[model samples]
Target: MNKKIGLWDLVFMNVSALFGIRWIAKSTASSFGLGLGAIPAWFIFAFIFFVPASLICAELASTYPRDGGLYEWVKEAYGEKSGFMVSWLNWTSKLFWYSSFLTFLMVNVAYVLGKPELAGNKIFVLVCSLVIFWVLSAISTKGMSFAKIFTNIGALGSTVPTILLIAMAFIAVIAFGYKPASTYTVSTLMPKLNMDSLVAISAVMFGLSGAETTANFVTEMDKPEVTFPKAIMISAALVAGLYVLGSIAITMIVPTDQITASEGVLVALDQVAVALGIGHWFIRIVAFGIALSVFGAIILYIASPIKMLFGSVKKGVFSDSFTKVNDHNIPVKAVYLQAIIVSAILLITTLLPSVDAIYNVLVTMTALTALFPYVLLFKSYIKLRKTRPNEKRPYEMSKNNGKAIAIANMVLIVCIIGIVCSAAPVMPSLGENIWYEVQMIGGGLIVIFAGLLIWKRFTKRTGFKESS
Candidate 1:
């Protein structure tokens, strides 16, 4: 039997999984691009959209503590086919997300190299991005032990720089008496519920999301029912605090209009460095840390989804090929297959007119893909509560079943509204149209359907036999 991870390990892993280095940079950059008012909107959405989602997950994770996480929970509640679809959508989204992170890593590398224009050079970014992706892929293929090391290192490496930068910004503000470009008024602080604001909020929500992994980690946890919910609450609180304070720090140092989607965090840090009489070398170090953070996220993107793929295969939902493993207990074939898809995405991105254009599409698509799993998970939670009322659950949200279901439903409704409204075509002249937005959502649906079709065909041909 595999050794169960202790309570502390589970907590740390859950926190690491939820709060990656890229999140800080991405959230900060998003605020700059969306406007300062957008920050509060994200806060609202996070509390309403994310908190309920976490609660739903807590109930599900405790009820169905298993290795496959979402795949197992959905399968138990719905069916194997639906579960496979959820996992497939998630795994597929990570492929494109990994490509986006690679772009982010390359952009930061250019910033550190003092060749900002190189980030826009598709060939350079693509080649360098592939190298980074493959290197991480190699490490991932060694085993989960190796991947866990990278996850811990990457989480710390990326998080320290963000916290340090936020601290430095505060010191700069106090020591130099720097004032923000805009006042911190109620109007500036609140997020508008308008179409454009809502869309931007959706993008930010994607950056903030990722608590669903708690279900996967529960089986490894020492006392999952008790410890897991505490960890989820702590992680959510910490992430919310970091995002709000980080955005304020960035706004204090740089004008919102000047924030670019790709390099916004680095740009803010650069300003802080100059203000504090810090040299270019020091700023470059921070940029390097930022790059590493994105790199770490890319590494997780490479490693996390293989388990889902393998689990689906074991359940006879996917082909036997995905179940193949190497001496190191790594899913080498799945890693390579995902890498190929990610590489293809990088190539397709190069053909796009601009990095921002490609990024917008990718970000939107990633959000849409992630949302599908949430919908299924929430539905599963409601069903399981009613159908399996007497099942042992380490953690129960409330003594009253009605209250728990109502809270879960509220969270689902808020997230659904946020996601649907954000997908509408409303962003200013970045060529965002109904067709493009529909393509993003439609593409995700197609991928999910395709997975279902493949699973049906595979099972029909094989007589639903589980492979050794």
Candidate 2:
């Protein structure tokens, strides 16, 4: 028998995949420019978006605990063509998403070296990104056993620092009497219903995602039908709770004006340490922790999606060579291919006019592309429920088709909203630049079309006719 993944390991794996503290900074920094309002916004999105998506994903994963995850479920419900597209979007979105993670890692590295200004130096950021990407890529090819070490460390990096920050925020406000930059009134907690707030929803949605990605590894667990749902529920609660408290902690220290998404966590750490009368060196230690957390998440993400996508090669969807696996059962060639594509993207985006602009665009594009798969995922869940009502599920979201379908529709509605808002500019500066909108929306369209073209070529080679 293959060695089974432990429940704690699975929980940490999901946490490392889904919970990056940089998002706390990102959300508090941009939370619809609402400051304290972002706190309640996290709760709102978690309820409307994260909770339902988690439940639906858990049901789908438990019912079909297979290797390819959403690819298998989607192909079962829709067809091979739809499954391939969903897998493609999931894989491609990671390429853009890697730029954001790489940027976060390097920014914290700059803070660690006591040269925070270097965070904005494009050349510095680019070199560090390349080195880190290649290093993680090489490590990933060694397989999940090696990757899990970082993920377990990442779970510590995420939870311990976040809890420390939250505790420090309380001390700073309650003991030291430092005035918060934002208020904590009822109206202030409520998010404003505006274009800015709409865009902020996209960020929250992005943060709450990766539950589906966890499905990709269900087959690695012992009694996955039981283990997968438990791990997901535990990690989901932990991640969502941390995000809310973590955002509150960030806003308590870092002034809204000084907070940039890329560097907000460092700013919060620096300010809180000073406010608490701790030496500045504390910030550097925390910065190193944040980097480890992001690195762990990146390595796991680096391997999961490619494993799912390349699994299609078994069905003859691609050349036989793409199915080549290392001694560790990882698809080495596909991983290298993903690395080259991301490296090229990282290199190209560095030449763009503004690093900030490029970062926001990459994030928005990732959010937009990421949602397309979830849209299909929710659809697959509902369809599978109706069509396979008798399918044995260790954890069913609801036995009643009406309840399951209603929750599935709720997820779909949020995905549509997220997709629409994600295509708009999140910052005032980018809002003024029409090309930001062009790049955000146009880039999403181009990626979707690229998937369609790939599907067409696959069909031509295999003589498989996709349903119109």
Candidate 3:
């Protein structure tokens, strides 16, 4: 093994990928009726979904240890058709997520420019999103070297501003005597078993996801079997803690009613600055930092998923041109294809009522589609443990197969429940709108169905067989 990446390197990479400050905003917004109960909701999902999913990923990575993450594991357990479905879902989910996330970036950029109202203007949003997405897409084709620089800057952007937000929130509440917008009592902290709360809890899964992205670097680790497990546990704890604390910080400052999913972080930061007797300059600075982080994250989403999809599948999965890479080792054709699809999504979202509405629908769709793969993932883990009992696993999720399978099933159940709840409306304006409901449930089905059609067509052309 080259052993280039150590435990800390893996830990930080996981943290950067898993922790997005924008998620704090989205989570707090989703916690609409739950109030402070959203904090415990984070812990609940972290245990049932995030933590177990990480362990399953760790075991899968160690056992397979090749480049493909979800695709390979699902393929070995099911077949190439299942594998392509996972990859297709994984890739397509990011397109919706990119719209939601990039719109968030533009929302913050509006704050930075002192034009907060522009965040809601569809034309302004559309123009800025297209420009930023294409510019980054062009840079991504240059090579990974350029993208790595932005990635490091983005990691800092996500971390530093989050720490500052959490600290400032407490300081405003304690030292400055600014009363928290919501009360956090024992009763208030208990998550309700209602539709709204379940919707919010499902959104938490989005915040804690991407832990498996770390598995791609398995080859660079020293004693990856031992190191991967330890790193995932530590990073999982850190990511979960930050999400809970950050969500609390946001709710503490911004009143629940005023919080917008896309702009809640900016709102909370503004409240913090006002309460601390600081200038709006502080808000602008942090907004700018968050925008940079969003930029870096956008680049990663654009390139990594397309790259992984191409890397995991055979040549016939897509046309030959789509599989070809340029001299810089960039999948130019695939990247361009993703950019076009995402652009179409962005354009179609103009029909949405507001910036918040656009974000809510896209994110709801993202959560529902994104979590479905975990169903297949958990199934893969259990099936592999039984069918390939003697197979080498660098870091098994559990020594006892019964215990491991149980844990996987538990995670699988949580995913199913979360996916169901995610179909509910996240914003009040959309609560009564039948179209919004259709968009949520209907959009997810369309994505999944499209993937199936493509997979069947490709598999037939390739003459792929289960045993092969």
Candidate 4:
């Protein structure tokens, strides 16, 4: 297989593939919504979700460094049914995630255009959001031979804004003696251990828990054992710190209440820009950066798994229509299918009362949908280790099998907890929008069932046996 990927390339891929900077403000806002301290919330989530999950991914990818990633891993460990489910989750999750990230981009664009009201205008947000999604879809329909530049810009786009916010935080402290609105007394900083205080578990996990998404590309790494772990260590640490510091940066400047999920970071940047005498020009620049970062992610995801999934369908029970490709062999139909589903989600989510609520709910829904696959991932890891003790592992967990099992179980519990938090109402009023939450849950079920339904239909159509 071709191996053009290296250490820095892996780092770039992992960073950009995971997420961009919107989480900084979203994490901080969601943290306070739980009445928990934002700083401790970041650390708690990092320990529970980010660190363990990354370690699990490294060991698994090293063991099964196939292009299939989760699908192959779960299939090998369990069976074809499990593999198909995992792949469905992987692909369908993108439908919801794209909606959230694209809405995030539109929010920043509104700031860039000096029209905050545009964010609240559902039609404006929907139009701009769909345009950008389709444009990227068109781009994804061709070879992204220049993907390196996208990863590089994505890494920069995700990090530079956080660094700026952190720098602004310190500058405000030194120049103006800025004090945080939420005090950091030990009690306030400590978690309450209740659902309300931890309702954003999905958001926190959503922000910190996506390194495994890049594992599919691990086959391209020159040395999966050394490079994958090293990249995970460095990128995970940097991304975690970005979340913590960026959240701090936001709260240090913008009040937690005023921080909108989608617009929080931009709002902070705008405030800091004005305070530093830079003005909306800085907002426009960072807005462009934020969009570029997301665009890079958009390009990466669109070009990766959907195409890979459709390729598998070609050998299976699916019709040619589903697997149809353009001159680029880019699964043109799947791209259009993804765009259509995502646009419907965007329209519904934009109907929420506020932009922040829309972004928050979208994030929660994405987290809920995206995370089911991780449950299968970690489970596959432990099961594989137990069932195939002698399997060749290019990289293994730290030499204590007992501790490894403990950590896996802990991560598993955390994963389930996080998913529940995301699906259920994180706050009181969230229940008032019971219909949206129901729709979110229902939407997820429809996606999962739709995958199975398609498989069953194809089996009848093509006589593709389930055993295969």
Return the top candidate by lDDT. 3
Residue by residue across 178-266, what tens digits does model 4's lDDT show? 66556656886665665534556677787776767666555566767677778877776766677777777888788776777778888
lDDT of 1 by residue, 366-465 (tens): 7667776778888888888888777777767765788878887887776686568556664454664654655666676678878878887878876874
TM-scores for the candidates:
0.88, 0.88, 0.93, 0.90
Name the runs in model 2 displaced over 4 angstroms. 1-14, 31-34, 138-144, 213-237, 326-332, 351-354, 390-394, 427-432, 466-468
In the range 48-68, model 2's lDDT, one tens digit per residue, is: 887678768777777777767
**How many residue pairs collide in each prediction?**
0, 0, 0, 0
**Lowest summed lDDT over 10 consecutive residues: which window, candidate 1?**
24-33
Distance (Å) between predicted and true CA of 302, model 4?
A: 2.7
> Tens-digit lDDT track for model 3 on 293-338?
8877788657888888887876687887988899887789888888
* Candidate numbers, best lDDT first, in rank order: 3, 2, 4, 1
**Lowest lDDT 10-residue stretch of candidate 4:** 29-38
Question: How does candidate 1 fare on TM-score?
Answer: 0.88
Better structure of 1 and 2 per TM-score: 2
Estimate the overall C-alpha local distance difference test score of candidate 2.
Answer: 0.77
Give stretches of model 4 more than 4 Å off.
Answer: 1-13, 30-36, 146-148, 192-197, 213-231, 426-431, 462-468
After superposition on all C-alphas, the RMSD of every candidate to the true structure, in Å, is: 3.5, 3.3, 2.2, 2.9
Q: Which of the predicted structures, 1 or 3, would earn the higher TM-score when compared with the native?
A: 3
